[model samples]
Target: MKQFYLSLIAFFTWVIGMAQSGGDSTRLPLTDSIQAKKSTFTIGAVYANDASYYGQRSDERLPYVALAAAYHHRSGFYLTGMGYRLLNDSARLASAYSLGAGFSFPLGKSFTADLSYDYSIYPKFSPFLQAANPHSVNLTIARESVVDLSISGDYAFGKTNDFFITPQISRDIDLFNIGRNDLVSFNPSLDMTAGTQHFYEYYQEEKGIRDSILGILMPPVLGGSPSEQNPTIKTTNRFEILSYNLKLPVSYNRNHLKLEVSGQFSLLSKQAQSQPGKVNSFFSAAFYYQF
Candidate 1:
């Protein structure tokens, strides 16, 4: 499994090099040349079936709500805010809030590079106390908080068409420990004007032993922190992923409406005994409007 993930990393690195070497002549979107700029506000929402809320196992397909607002300007600078609520059965599982700002700079004729910063807040839990014997811990499952930073560059293969391909790399940080279980990923995308887009990504995550211990104790135990006097378990975790997404893009210029569909599939680690990884899938749709 480690070898496979290493190879995947190499492949993505090669792709990035190739895209940069030969993409100088690619066409640029007409929108990039249009100088008439305006700032607009928009709102959007999404619904997914069989989706895990906040990455919690107890989450079901009941309903998830996302509220968003953005300020976009023609010069390629934007600011956005998003909030999400995940519900399962009849109770709220988790909620998240995010804020971001980004800028797009022309690479040449048609390509653009984007740099963005995002901060997200998730409910907190003490990992130290989470460790306990299977029969002793009876606490409800806790959620993890994460913050992500990413930089991406994309090229437009069409002049008037909306089709383009983008490749991005990102690092995710756990806010709790400031630990480096960070992940690096690549995303390649294709899109059309009707809000349909298809994409595939490869990702790798560094895991730790503490996660394995929690995995073993979580299913059987109800709750309670581990005894402060016990020795802490030690282990390491690393996993690779190949994911595919068919997404519908929502664009609202002004008084316009949009709807899109998206789905994803992922494969997890094979050697992780306690947290052995996952194979999961989901589909979702969205509705949105521009004012």
Candidate 2:
């Protein structure tokens, strides 16, 4: 992992150096149609502090750096996935990730809708373990003009049968002169989520945490004497607002390539706020290209 990260740093340094010298980074993979269709192939690296994306705490807190690849077409179809190396918490390169494929289409004058299925796979100790679900179908609709408005739904298929809905709004502003022919912009957005009780069940350690190691991290929450008839009841769980977050993303674009850097400041609602050692902010850096 250390060597891989060092290599990645070198790769980015070289790319940026060439771009600054007015050199081209095109790979010669496509022709005029690729440029006209706005077909893009992208790879990026992300540094995230929020290990507990489900809004829960663990005994250990570790930041993660992930590598991601994605492809998009002007026709509104995309495929994307991430591979992560867990830092401090574990020493695995492919510890956790989600892969998604989807299609998008215009709904009306300014509205567009997307449909996709996300497959989340976590091998090591991660928040997704308790839910017993890995498959989720996501749907999103939004407008991307002067102001952006989007709503999304995610339904997990598993024993937990969890579902969540999120609504968001955003705006973009032009930044100061970055490069003469390059574009710079900053996007700020806010979003809120409401979800089913099953999604939050990871918080209830007594009922969840089937793995012995995970049980140690969370600790059993339920208590009963030797004479107790039932240890834990299924009806004790309830649902509330899942989370809300404010995100700021800035980007620079030149030619058919763009480099983006962003920060996500998040706030959890209801029982989700009680997490300890949980980092509420995540940062990312990405480079994208078309044609």
Candidate 3:
């Protein structure tokens, strides 16, 4: 498993190198050509059938309300405060998370690099999260181009350590030029994550040791009865490919306000233990005010 993840890391690294030097003209992809404001705030909500990523996934739709405020320094240093709340079934999972800061700098004037650290909390006791655990700290390193690659690691949390290696590529097409300062664009993106099984515990009906402990504390069904059939129990920390996600985000950007509606489909690996009925797909609409 470790070897597979290491290979995944190498593969993305190679892709980044190719992106930076692959073109016949040796020109880089277009990035933010204008100088962006130093400070910005984004407030939005994501309503989806499930939260799917390389390191984690929920077979069920759990909505997230999120807010973010960030400041970028002239020296390439940036800090951000982020928070989110999970809607529905609050008794079993966590809500409102991730405070982080990072730095982004130009790499040879062709690519960009970012490094960040984050501390997050999972407020509920389930196979997926532990409220009693220490504030989880994670570090991420990223290289950006036409395709972006991020490698992150989590420490001091669950019984087994984990890493999230993701590669994301996005393309944008202008549906129409609404005006000089206003237009709508259709953005399609592909994000792939490969990591440990701990992030995908939700798909399996079986409970691990930590889940068993939580179950022991609470009744089998919350004023309900135990099932007659046996449930499957699995171990944790097994590494595997997590998901391949494709997202279509249609955004209408008019000045400082951005409105978007998107649908995401994820083809999770067979190891996810998810059935056809518990598929990973969702649609979401978001409103953001950026300044």
Candidate 4:
């Protein structure tokens, strides 16, 4: 994981060096679309502090960096591509990567509809087991990957555009064959910046983790017996997490600086078993800058 982050940092450093030498990073991707007026290239880093176990002081910190190139055409077409990489604190932790694409088109004079898809994947690793007191081992479970697809449209009302409403439906895929989460959200936007916006989004995952993981089999080695090469462990345990998120954008400079902050809360309860879920609430903040 450390090497992964180091490599990402090295790549970005190389890009920055190229940018300093009069090479255009925006033109590096969509060479045909570099003629747009409102195009920009941005880079930013974010730090997030997460607390779990019903907020009982199980805190974790994660940091990541992102880069994006965006273009707005004279025909009202918009396109953007972004790459993000997670920095891991532990050598055994997995580093995550994400690719996002989005487009927004005018629905009317005062409204626009935006469709976006973000695909994220994490490297595979075994759970961490630390010896505690020489007699007990503490197991830290692995984080799963989720693919998020979201579609939203907003209608602006009021003369000053101070008040508006937005409705969106989104789906979350486990990607690892665990389970799927789907939900719809009704969000409202308020004007905060000069033509800038603030939004609140709320949604839920349709299925729980227990139902999702039950069909998947444990590793053959863990289930093997002395007489039988493979055996099945008999235990019925399952749980699901209900989640909600609040998203807010603080700064936007189209070229220089953009900041985003999000807070998330989740409720976990055992369905077939009587164990508590490992996670509780998480908060994340991100920033971007372009030169």
The candidate that wins on lDDT is 2
Give the alpha carbon lDDT tens digit for every residue of 1-291 in model 2: 355346435643543333322232222121112224577776666676646454443334556787877777878677888887767644565667788888877788878788888787865335443335678898988775555689998887664676778888766556555677776766666776676555334434423344455454322334544224233324324445656666778877677676777887656553442442233676766665554
What C-alpha lDDT values do all the predictions have?
0.35, 0.60, 0.52, 0.31
Q: What C-alpha lDDT, on a 0 to 100 scale, does residue 25 get in candidate 4?
A: 21
The candidate with the higher TM-score, 1 or 3, is 3
lDDT ranking, best first: 2, 3, 1, 4
Q: Which consecutive 10 residues in model 3 have the weakest lDDT in total?
A: 25-34
Candidate 1's C-alpha runs over 4 A off are 1-37, 50-63, 89-94, 126-255, 269-278
Candidate 3: list runs displaced more than 4 Å: 1-46, 89-94, 126-159, 199-236, 273-279
TM-score, cand. 4: 0.36
Model 4 per-residue lDDT tens digits across residues 1-291:
355346435643543333322212221122122234455444555555642212212112334444555555544344555553445435533344445455445444434444444343433321111000011111111111121122222222221121212222222211121123221111111111111111100000111122235453433435764235311112211112212122322322233444455554432222211122432455666665553
What TM-score number comes out for model 2?
0.71
User: Against the true structure, what is every candidate's RMSD?
Assistant: 17.1, 11.0, 7.9, 20.7
Model 1 vs. true fold: TM: 0.45
Error of 1 at 255 (Å): 7.2
| Order of the predicted models by TM-score, top scorer first | 2, 3, 1, 4
Give lDDT tens digits, candidate 1, residues 1-291: 466466557744654453432111111111121122555566777776654311212212334667777766777776778776765423334465667676655555433455555555543321211111101101111111121112222221111111222222322211121224322222232211111011110000111233354474432253553432221222211222122222222221212444455554433333322222554555666665554
